[model samples]
Target: MAEKRTGARKSSSDGDDGASSRKAPSKKAPSRKTPAKRAAPKAEAPRRATATQVAARAAQQLLELTGKEAEGVTGLGRADDGWTVEVEVVEVRRIPNTTDVLALYEVTTDDHGDLMGYRRLRRYTRGTPGGE
Candidate 1:
């Protein structure tokens, strides 16, 4: 009887084994790109002060300058560069509340509510007409 092959053998026509005839798909990494730059935002300007803010600042500054307590805001007016505020303060104490002496101060401040200057306009008793 003739001898038979026991295991797999290469094909003479393709020079490879039967299992190596089919190949696996190839694998590759994806490409990358650099990021773009962005521009910075602009800054905002300072805002103007309101009538109430200006009045409060004027009263506070007057108290600091004269060492007196502010009683109330009597007047407020807008200027070209800032504001003019009139503040009332007690200058002297008396037995009767109505007889107490008070003073009106004209306070000037910049648009940002910074004290520019201040001066006492007039002095009168609490019961005086129009607080004059």
Candidate 2:
């Protein structure tokens, strides 16, 4: 007669079914946290114009009205409201080259280099000296 093996483990320590090897999972405590508050952004100040930009704006404004070209920029300044620039322009052409007439104009512009207004300060000939 042939005898067949049953294959069953005789002791708990000799077998590993996984359920007897692991411990129960522990419970974790709940966390209590408050979200932080954010600060509001501030408003930015207006930007000021540069000296070069101010002079260029003045010349452009003068040319837009007179059609005459600007000769040079004489002065630049800043006021409470905006910037100021002094520009020289050729007003009238004369027969003799020394008799050519030139004019000094005061131009005002905003902080952003926008031309606001302009006015003629004085007129003189090209050959005339600076004191007048």
Q: Which model scores highest in TM-score?
A: 1
Give the clash total for candidate 2.
Answer: 0
Task: Please provide TM-scores, in order, for all candidate models, with all chains considered together.
Answer: 0.65, 0.61
**Range of the 10 consecutive residues with the lowest summed lDDT in candidate 1:** 1-10
Task: Look at candidate 2 and give me any clashing residue pairs.
Answer: none
Taking all chains together, the TM-score of candidate 1 against the true structure is 0.65
Give a tens-digit lDDT track for model 2, residues 25-100: 8677665543443244455676676888778977997899889789899988988888889999999988886788
Q: What stretches of model 1 exceed 4 Å from their correct place? A: 1-42, 130-132
Q: What is the lDDT of residue 78 in candidate 2?
A: 89
How far in Å is the alpha carbon of 98 misplaced in model 2?
Answer: 2.5
> Model 1 over residues 5-47: C-alpha lDDT tens digits?
3222324334565437656465765645434432444455678
